[model samples]
Target chain A: MPQTHDDVAETTPARADVVEMVGLHGFVQLAAFARLATDAEHAPDLRAQVTISRMAAGELAALDQLETVARRVGADLYEAMASYSTVLADFDRRTPPGDWWERVVRTYVAYGVLADLQRVLSRAVAPDGRPMLDDVIADSGYEDFVVAMLGPVVAADQQLSARLALWGRRVVGEALGIAQRLLAEHPLLWSFADRQDGARSEGDDAAWLRKQLSGGHARRMGRLGLTA
Target chain B: MPQTHDDVAETTPARADVVEMVGLHGFVQLAAFARLATDAEHAPDLRAQVTISRMAAGELAALDQLETVARRVGADLYEAMASYSTVLADFDRRTPPGDWWERVVRTYVAYGVLADLQRVLSRAVAPDGRPMLDDVIADSGYEDFVVAMLGPVVAADQQLSARLALWGRRVVGEALGIAQRLLAEHPLLWSFADRQDGARSEGDDAAWLRKQLSGGHARRMGRLGLTA
Candidate 1:
């Protein structure tokens, strides 16, 4: 984390850019919670329903902490959050899940890639930004839960796994598209990635800085007996 | 709350029925959260959006506590909760909201009436039951939020108030029907209400043990500049 405005200004993201990154992180969390909460509602198995609902609650708590950080840094949470609502909404409309299994794979795959993206942005942000990201990006935490719940089913049914492998590919493609658009719109946050990683990758590639970001989702999908 | 099985058996609801009541309560909390979380999603005003999302989170927390009580009493939470899912789902299907204001009023009116019904059932159940009910029934707490948020808007627009007034009545009407059906189905739990309140009007009217139950909503509606 950068210590001073001048130092951060010279290398990492500036204060305003940090605030914007925090807000964008909040939007990601709010969007995930809203979508998973719906999945939880339609989940017929009470165990799955309750577990997903609890996961959704965890996402909201992460958003609340980020909002607190945003306010502390003189950012209007709503203003910061609403700034990128359409970016996520467009992704949602384009990748609407066709069935319960699709919904499960969608949440499982999309959350992984987005959380990983949030983590990378955290590395590039100012001091306060890291904690906000830290709360959301517990590496492989959500992945473990979704896999344990869905992997057994996917393993038992060859047909379901084959169908979901395709769905998983589609979800990641759109997720990456939104990830690129967000980084493109906020290039200052992109600079933080370059400064932190010491990579000379183009701004568009800022979102994919470490192959490790996409690796987590692909590995989780593989665990589920589906292609990434 | 009743301490011993025999003591609870003598006058209050049996352990099984008490467990059923707890599960039914869980369904109520879960359904409210599911509905309001969607309301939070559609709420365009960010302040209202976050506040409703927070309120939705509170409903889930209340559900979690009841689930704890249910499990402590050896109730399979899923079985207990699923028993009443259709009852609430049917209520939801019948009274779909027309717009955002209707959505807000629907939550406000429906939650008030149902929580009051849960409170009355608590009075008659075994000893451990009251606390579960108490957590969900904080006495017009949610109403305060709705009134403050919508009261002025209703006061300013005669057409919106009239429209919402109709919507509010419909929501309460359906809410009361489901509340009545639940009491009718679990007549043993209804007996707990009579025993605790010392009122012998009728088992069918068990849900209406006290006028104060419905009064909360009617009064809150008046405060919101709508006819209850």
Candidate 2:
């Protein structure tokens, strides 16, 4: 993990890069927590929040612990997390809560997009390192939870399908907007995208992301008793 | 795990109690996220947060997934997680940011105390149910991380020793503050506390908590290069 380039970088250290990355992870972790907190609110009662909080706390602790390990392993852990976070934070900061549908769409679409990207990125890691990445991906029970939550509501009301479908489109638009920012900032990640099998063109990654979003939205809408 | 109560008072459904417990878990999870976010700020560079976030996310997801399983198994997962979260959240929401020492101390002492309690409570469950409790308790890596974080900080800064010791005391006060609220809200938890080690009185439970806090604080302080 301790490559010569990393050692040289540590010595001459682009301080601004370091700061930016830390800021990014901070923003992203905050967004993650906010999402968790908001989701917990939908729980049946305060007890549910407590339960969710403990789970969330453990996450926080694990993040800190992993950062410590990354430091030992000579990788810039903060920068990696921050790269993702910066995009998310900016999105949240720009998009004020418009309505419940908007919020729900954001959760479903935004996370779904990120998770797809992560799933791809996780594959790039060495085989041994994949376990941790898999673990992170595994914990995103949000999709299932969202489906369960919406199932009842959708069953009761048919009109929600049309409304959410529109909301899903807007959510996809916002996601693509942020993703462009992410690509511009992270050359390594962009390079990885370029190296992908079918993503040889400049806008290929964006197109692929859109396709994923479309597919995910369609699946979720149908699950919620909606027509895409 | 659902006990049939012949007495009418015991049989009455306690919705409020359930809510309070769940809320507590939410609080703890939020605080944990906050603390992790803050700790991420101390990372040497940006990439560190990425690693940390991955770890944190995994831990959080695990906790949440486990709770979902507990819910399926009729173990009131929300209530259990909430009980822990309530104390943590109250501490986070009320505590000033200047109290960094106290924050670390609380992480060290508070988690250890809870883990010990979990160890005892794990026994109360029947053999079939004990494994899940054991898995949750076992997966908590707080002690290792705390030791790692505090070891160098304490060794390098002598002034931090006295400051952290006092901070440890304050953390206990904060814990007690939330503990009282929890006890008032959840008689089941209190009863669980009392039944542990055949203790029957509230005073006894308080004493046990105090002793645990003091010992945990001492151990953590020692790790932080302080004289316990």
Best-fitting candidate, measured by TM-score? 1
lDDT of 2 by residue, B1-228 (tens): 222112322232333433333334334444444455454444444554433334344334434534443443445555555455435555666655455455556666665555454433333232233322224444445566666866777778778777776766666567555555555566555433424376657787767756755675567556666655
Cα lDDT tens digits, model 1, B106-180, are 888888877777766665344555333454544425678888878989989999999998898888878877777
lDDT score, residue A75, model 1?
70
Chain A TM per prediction: 0.82, 0.68
TM-score of each predicted structure versus truth: 0.87, 0.60
Docking class of 1: medium
TM-score (0 to 1) of chain B for each candidate: 0.82, 0.66
Q: How many clashing pairs does model 2 include?
A: 37
Candidate 2 local lDDT, A44-138, one digit each (tens) = 55554444444444334334533533453455554446456446656776655566655666676776665555444433232232222223344
Question: DockQ for each candidate?
Answer: 0.64, 0.16
C-alpha RMSD by candidate, in order = 4.5, 8.7
> Where does candidate 2 stray beyond 4 Å?
A1-85, A96-102, A116-142, A154-167, A186-228, B1-76, B79-88, B99-102, B119-136, B158-163, B180-205, B226-228
Which residue pairs of candidate 1 clash? B1-B127, B2-B127, B124-B192
